[model samples]
Target: MIDATRPSAPPRRILVVDDDAGMRDSLEDLLSAAGWTVTTFGRAATALAKLPEVNPDVVLADVRMPGMSGLELLRELAKPEMPPVVLISAHGDIPMAVTAVQEGAYSFVEKPYEPHRLLSIVQHAADQFRMAADTKRLRARLASLSGLDRVLLGQTEEIRTLRQDVLDLAESEAPVLLVGETGTGKELVARALHDLGARPGGPFVAINCATLEQDRFEMEMFGAKDGPRGFLGEADRGSLFLDEICSCPERVQAKLLRAIETGTFNPVGADSGASSDFRLISASNLEPEKAVREGLLRADVFYRINTFVLRLPPLRQRLEDLPLLYSHFLDEFAAVYEIEPPQTSHEDMAALLAHDWPGNVRELRHVAERHVLAARRGRGSAAEAMSNDQQRSEFPGTLREAVAAFEREMVGRAIRAHSGRMDAAAEALGIGRRTLNEKIVKLGLDKDNWL
Candidate 1:
């Protein structure tokens, strides 16, 4: 029986395999000197047999041997939970050693190896193994936390059913089409799907299709010579989320179709093609089938993405979630401002619920931020501010004019409340002090008469 309390042993078990008895002894001496529990086997088959008993942390195997070559030993140990294998080879065996690494060997060390180099490789392999294990544990924990029970935030039957669908689709790699209006949290659902899936460690890349100009759409999606690699390449081995999929131009749609089918794309101006192994999740405010019928989207592309559709209910449809979402946003903004969350009166909730939220959750978020800022500036309560909106009946001439008027009013209020303290006013408005000063100068609010 191996003594578990041996002082000369390494911190973990290390198996050394070499055909030559002298080489095996030398390796064992070096590894043992470095405080490892070293085990030596002259034959690769013997080492393979001992592996089940020892459960070594790392295997340092000589590539060329009499029987059961290092490559063969590596293949046998490729089973799950097996320790990482490091290949040792001669100068002439560099090509084979490279092949070994490609076949899942942790690393390759050329022989006759320097003791320090061998020790470095062993330490690195052990650390990488530990990191991989830790990441797996973290992913499992995240998945458990983000389970179906936790994902669906509301108790409504619609939300409950949607949550179940999300859970079911989380296990699949098929493309998902999330149809929702702007600010409906489509990206949030996409992330949940990726996290709950098998390849949680893979990257998640999102592209807002509506934000890209029509002429630049192809280069942005497929990558350009002067620009960084596009979203598709960036999301290799993970997921790519295309927001506002209907806005993807006809030319770009053609490239996307080819990429989805072949898992390959040639970067703009690149001669060679690169392959990506990733899942697709796309979102759009417009109905994809309707868009295809209108000729705004390709029929084939629509069919390809319509495999699994998840329609997010608009805020108006799910008014029950308003109170919870409102309170959540209140707490979020309050924490950022370092102020206690403002109290919401029952009348305020009623008014908020009654109003038609054309801007959806994004509008609600801004309203909450504005309310918090107003409350901080001694503007009574958020509800009182809403009641005052009825006093301003005359609408501004233009949209830009209306926005500027609202900005002036808010800035004026902040300035008066803070006794002309621009810094405090800027903080309340969530704008930089310099920016507030620039606006004040531009809008002719620098005079005391404005205050």
Candidate 2:
């Protein structure tokens, strides 16, 4: 019996328990030949002792064992999360078998059961168990998506859709490319993918491609011949997250493409290829096609890594979640500082939602921290701490006017701080340089004045 919905998880394993050694051997041989890894114990007590270690998909046991009856084992393993228990009953034990099945036993097989029938039942039970486990795990992940350490918190349509996408891709192994504005939490999504996937137990190797020097990147990614292993080696059997992938030079991109295509790399000075099986998750804040056209990214590399491109929407696109997201950060900081979260006013909410958050969620996080700090330090209204000027009567003109003024000041300040270098300014403002350029044109800011 095949289950279409069963998760591709651990292999099937069966535990057999009976005082009869011959019966145990027969059951092991039968189950093993049927493609189930089988472990057999002579006693129900011994099987119980090895239960945690075996962690079988199904337990096949004799109902009338001497030390601990299979009925007792059924009671012991009756948790809703535990695997199904199948009891082997004798001809005279039909009534007891019925009672056992009523008391949470999966089903009972008579002593003279047909091998095919038994295998069928076992397969059905294992598939159901796997289905239950996957459902429980998915529900748990969704519930804890926004834990204190994780920041993917929002209820807006945009955020909700993004969160669902993350969950859908979490269990998959195909390469994924993240395209989102900086500060939209691409790294966070990568972390979530690593944590929720099949390789959670393995290392998560993360590096910002933008920060890697060309020659240095090859050495770090492919490793040294004998002395050191690179990020590719470290990520074996796990995940590798590359942020700002558009910044990777053509030379590095070629080597990266080869490594990803073949799952093997020749370390510096190595004689032969070494393999590292890692799930590749790359992120680029700039529009991917634009980056390729601009010669910032390799077209071949882009195509290879973009098996699934997930786009995370910027905060302004999901403004309906502003209050929830801001409150989350306020609560987060308050707990860290061991102070009560300050009460934000209607004016504070207005200030927050009035403007487009150019820097996205990362900007909101910073603002929220500042807002909390202001109250902690006895400063006035939290919203005014960043965007409000007393002489401006909250804002200078229309909603667009108010938002534009705040955005221009913020973007210009970031550019000025970086001496008008767009790359540095973009990094400082938690946005791509292309996005910053668009912002500059839209806001009508003179970069020379800022410099």
Candidate 3:
């Protein structure tokens, strides 16, 4: 079995920097024969110059050189981003090479070298360098990617169509209106519109309109003369996301509509001539049309910004995606907390899929985090609230009835976890596939729940 803790090593790159051309060629050929991609440089300066371009996993340099000595080259590449450097020299210079290793070199290798010993040292250095590089790359990816894609995970028909809609919307400059129930990832969709759009390089400024106090709404949207910068100015030449747009006060909505229509806005206390530039992206957990009819959202404002409307589907409507979404969150929290991800038992999976997920993807993520926390604290099973409160409230009349209910729930979860793969699900439940199928039938568990 492959150890999960071990990183898969990519092809190693070894940079050989030696002033002796014959020695450089010899080292390069030897390392290349050992399955490494080798680059030979006759001068340390040349190697340093090519460092960024070649990005060798390890550097093998002779201790003495004409201009830039191996020690000097090691110092130059001593920064965090540089790969490991191994210093080499003749027996007479072994002490100097050892001193170089003490300073920062990966290791010291003596001349009249043992081929296997040299290969072993270089291989270890390269593997360590590669693992560190992989970690850095993962962190970089986590920082740059907005994580909006995770919200729209799964290969279901609904997700496939939604992805296409998002791609189509990205090419347009029109204002986008996102509608979804609370926790259905409205904000994520709003971010996706801005991030995937043609103006992705521009800033993405977001504010929750519903949370803004009525008195401070204007000042927050439009900068005040003697107050802090407004979201409008901050989002100039970029996207301004107004979350819970339907919650914007009626009077403020009129002013916002004017700004969108005229491509200018009046800062709270600035001269009437002062104007702001920005693209608008709005979201509402409420149904936009209903909100307008109920006077919560201004009809005119809705018309002004509803050029492109997207509705995020609730989690319950996409039950088949539960396993994938659960795994995604599990992996995310595992990485964040630096712990091995906890496994979802048959019962735990059933509880996850059976829940309506009223809070949608956001709720599921929080639950997954809680599961991780619980597992770290030595609780191997799913947390009590893994199943919804309403569902758990039902009481079995007898102890035998309660035990049966528990068994049924676990079977259901196992099936769902495996996406109705009976053999795999049964194996996870430690039962033969035929026996599991019989139990499912006897328990009267709805196959639709897992399928």
Candidate 4:
């Protein structure tokens, strides 16, 4: 049972290229004994042809070869991105081998080299190759996130700042505390911090403190001798995110403080403590300051974990970003349900904007999903279709009526404030002149009063 999310080490491979048939065989046998897949080529040219296919971790080539000398082969293969090559040379060719190394070969060995010494050199190259590949892979993965990841989704000032804050926080080893209301996607932000950080390949272990009972919280967090490895142990060398940290029991809080301070924790029923090295990321749905004032959270633990803090803005506070979020979720739901995305009229948009989204972005996404489902089922106009169960408790009884009322009031005010100047009114309302005029005509507002 392999953990697919865990990064596996790159396979070890050695390419032996020596025109001497006996020497090639000996090198192959030695590397194979060292538990590496070895491939032999009689000529440097033949090895070059197989380089891409085999992609060996290290290349061992003879200094004097038939088609291409080892130095010439090094010239062709010593790319910054390619696997390291170690040249084998006779004592007399020491100077040429040294030149090969200067050109980017990892190292060179004399003809009468010790087997152990040669193995040690190749092992070093293998380790270096693995590290380089891992770094490249991690960089590629992080770059992919900047394009399609959801953490940086909105166009609001708050979102832009949050993205930059995340990047800055990721550059350190300090603990992170995320504070926001429920459904504000705190976990997503935590993951972004982990994925973009130095240990992207490490595990991202998460647990909801609110879900853990007082008696089980310690065991779940710190692990036990006879039981499974707890979250802390599992997240070693990675990150551990505890959601609703305010809900952590008093007893567990003390232990957590010790773990972070000492980098070790006593597993349940174990006499000796175990090492626990991981980044700590915590989230609290409640106002952390309020919680501390109320004595629900320990002041000491809060200080330790709150080294870096980020607050995710509630969706209602960033209403201008509603359209982007709506479209994002609309496409997601459409693809998930295999249906066309439902069109949202200006009135429908106004209704959504008018409602107070207590569930934040999570609530908005559900509404988008339901709207698409209802439209696919041949329901009423998008407004009426979403008027029933999907309507927020804070919204008016009928979505269409509420939308009409909101539009008339807001548009009329914008028009009156601008003295019926369509261009000024449109700009004031954050809309285009054509849009404002259409709303004015549809709502049957009298322009004479402001004009």
lDDT measured at residue 144 in model 3 versus the true structure, 0 to 100: 44
| Per-candidate local distance difference test | 0.78, 0.82, 0.79, 0.81
Say which candidate scores most in lDDT.
2
**Between the candidate structures 1 and 2, which one is better when assessed by TM-score?**
2
Backbone clashes in model 1, listed as residue pairs: 10-35, 10-36, 10-37
Clashes of each: 3, 0, 1, 0
Please give the range of 10 consecutive residues that has the lowest summed lDDT in model 1.
385-394
328 Cα displacement, candidate 3 (Å): 1.2
Question: Can you write out model 4's per-residue Cα lDDT over 324-435, one digit (the tens) per residue?
Answer: 8888888888899898888878988888888887778877777787787887796634356446545454465697768876888898888788887778988998987655
RMSD of each: 18.8, 12.8, 19.8, 14.1
Cα lDDT for residue 255, candidate 3: 81
> Looking at candidate 4, what is the lDDT of residue 171?
70
Two-way lDDT contest, 3 vs 4, winner: 4
Residue 212 of model 2 has an lDDT of 63
Those runs of model 3 whose alpha carbons end farther than 4 Å from true positions after fitting are 1-144, 383-451
Question: What's the lDDT for candidate 1?
Answer: 0.78
In candidate 4, where is summed lDDT lowest over 10 consecutive residues?
Answer: 143-152
1 or 3, greater by lDDT: 3
User: What is residue 211's positional error in candidate 4, in angstroms?
Assistant: 0.7
Query: Which one wins by lDDT: 1 or 4?
Result: 4
> For model 3, how many clashes?
1
| Per-residue lDDT of candidate 2, residues 266-377 (tens digit) | 8888998899999999998777897786566789998999999888888888888788888888898889877889888899889888877767888788777777777788
